[model samples]
Target: MARQSGRHFSGPRLSPEQAARQGRISQLAIARLGAREAIAFLNGNDEKLGGRPLDLAIESIEGLRAAEQRLDEWAEA
Candidate 1:
């Protein structure tokens, strides 16, 4: 955060591409896991990824790929 005009302002928001990536992960999760389970899966920490799936998905393309792969793996199992 930064102060401007004696008011605090937050950091930059996600870019359009980042928002799109987040949507991709969310939609995929909802498709495979259903709404309730998808919410849990995204929020829950994964042993393989070593982080929350949603966080990873939002971070980068590579992390998004890993998250999607994990979801597929979960659905398969």
Candidate 2:
């Protein structure tokens, strides 16, 4: 852990792109899945994604699109 002003940092900070991905995915999930399902979907592992949707989405543009596609599929069902 890094220390600054006697405070210890817990983990690496999110970059701007990662932050953007998180915001986008969260909004989409909440809008399509509602609050409860959105939380579960983001935090839970997805068989189709092969990882937690939120983590995949923040990893890259392709992952974000994949997560969005899954969200759409769930919303339509």
Candidate 3:
């Protein structure tokens, strides 16, 4: 679906823990940004994330934390 939608994802294969974190971030985005916007945000590059999105978080735990932090800050605002 993402490829069909022209979204590009480049990162490492996700571990179970990383996948769980991704799911949590998605849920947070859904709650704060709404479903459609959350999907777009997840698929889009974020400046706060160093021009990376949640998809790139799979490459490293630090990347996942950065993504989570961005979402957390967004939720607080």
Candidate with top TM-score is: 2
Which pairs in model 2 have colliding backbones? none
C-alpha-based local distance difference test score of model 1? 0.93
**lDDT, candidate 3, 1-77, per-residue tens:** 35466667886576798787688778878998899878887888887677655775665677777887787776677
After superposition, which runs of candidate 3 have C-alpha atoms over 4 Å from their true positions?
A: 1-13, 73-77
Each candidate's TM vs. the true structure? Answer: 0.81, 0.85, 0.62
Tens digits of lDDT, candidate 1, 51-71: 999999999999999999999
Where does candidate 1 stray beyond 4 Å? Answer: 1-12
Supply candidate 2's per-residue lDDT for 4. 58
Report the Cα lDDT for candidate 3: 0.75
What is candidate 3's TM-score against the reference?
0.62
* Residue 50 C-alpha lDDT in model 1: 94
Candidate 1 lDDT at 40 equals: 90
Q: Give the alpha-carbon lDDT of every model.
A: 0.93, 0.93, 0.75
List the candidates ranked by TM-score, beginning with the highest. Answer: 2, 1, 3
